[model samples]
Target: MGIIQSLKRFFSKQTETSEKNHDQALQSHYYKMTKDKTFRELENFFSEKEGFEIRSVSEEHGEMIVKRTKGKPAFIVVTIIMVRPFRTSVDFSVASETMLFTDFGSSRRLIYGLYEELNQRLTFVGTGLGDELAK
Candidate 1:
């Protein structure tokens, strides 16, 4: 990582996973699982982790809002969308609640960590598929 990139990351309070993210770790990840199953797994995973609390869930929209109340507080939004049968994409938006200018990449780290966990539990698929799988 270049110094400019590092500085930008350090000063940024939020990070979101997307299909074309320059940072590979921040790219949207695809999994071979049903949306419902993925949602359940995510809820259970967060519930099992200490200091993390699920604030709300919208099954209709396939979205979950989570809050980290313990050390280094953060707000997280998890989105799961099914592009095809048994092909789902998971994206994360995380924002660190720090009192200073930046969170020092805490949000990025949190998203990366969450993706790592999901990758371990779910069937792996390629990242940043976008519409390539549709056509």
Candidate 2:
């Protein structure tokens, strides 16, 4: 190829490589967030409960998997997934027919309890709660 063509190809390849590297870096950052010590503690706490199971766990995607059982359903189903960004200034969610936030663990408990109650009610009726309930 000519000189100009060769230069263009070289620059194009460099741009592609840079974009791939950036994407990889972002993925790694997300993974670190998911595997954070505090987050893991929460995951373990939920996973060890008698009536619940973890469906999936991922820091990169900011999602926590949970499964719950309901009497009317006659079968267990995945429910109550949690998601929160790692670098956000505050944590908040709209689930269980309400919105909640926390700067301290105390508030977190209240929100979680409320969510559980809502989940129980909805699940009892054999109606699935939408993502809004768990956000």
Candidate 3:
């Protein structure tokens, strides 16, 4: 592959991998997978690790929204959805802070890395979340 093609493939990772079927299935599979701490943990994760400030969370709905508090970050729009008990599906959408037409997978790397950490810590979900979730 050419350098540009490789960069596009790596950087501008598609959005389809964000919400997965397995993630959907996980929700209905359990009534209380690991208690309702998933969203809370997510709130904490984004804040403590990514330095994202929590904007809002609906505990009843099991969802949260977080974003960068400082200058414009590489990515924006973080949505965490608890599809089912103990199953949380996350989607991170990026709008480059600069004028670049494409990113070198910075967004994908950020989200997937954090997702893997979350899967590891959460322990309810399996690994990688899926390479599909990344480049």
**lDDT (10s digit) by residue, model 3, range 12-61:** 53322343433332221111243356666666777786457777667765
Candidate that beats the other on TM-score, 1 or 2, i.e. the better one: 1
In model 1, the clashing pairs are none
Writing each residue's lDDT as its tens digit, candidate 1 over 1-135 gives 789987888789999999988898898899999999999999999999999999999999999999999879999999999999999999999988988998877888888888898899899798999868868
Best by lDDT: 1
The models' CA-based lDDT, in order, is 0.91, 0.33, 0.51
Ranking by lDDT: 1, 3, 2
lDDT (10s digit) by residue, model 2, range 1-135: 578754553333111111112222111111112225435654665566555566666676545645443211111111222235432111223112112331223322333453344334332212222232347
Regions of model 2 farther than 4 Å from truth? 1-35, 70-135
Task: Please identify which of the two predictions, 1 or 3, would achieve the higher lDDT against the true structure.
Answer: 1
TM-score for each predicted model, relative to the true structure: 0.92, 0.31, 0.57
Residue 133 error for model 3, in Å? 18
Which ranges of candidate 3 are over 4 A from the true structure? Answer: 1-16, 19-35, 69-72, 82-85, 127-135
Spell out the clash pairs found in candidate 3. 11-105, 27-84
Instruction: Show how many residue pairs clash in every candidate, following the order shown.
Output: 0, 2, 2
How good is model 3 by TM-score? 0.57
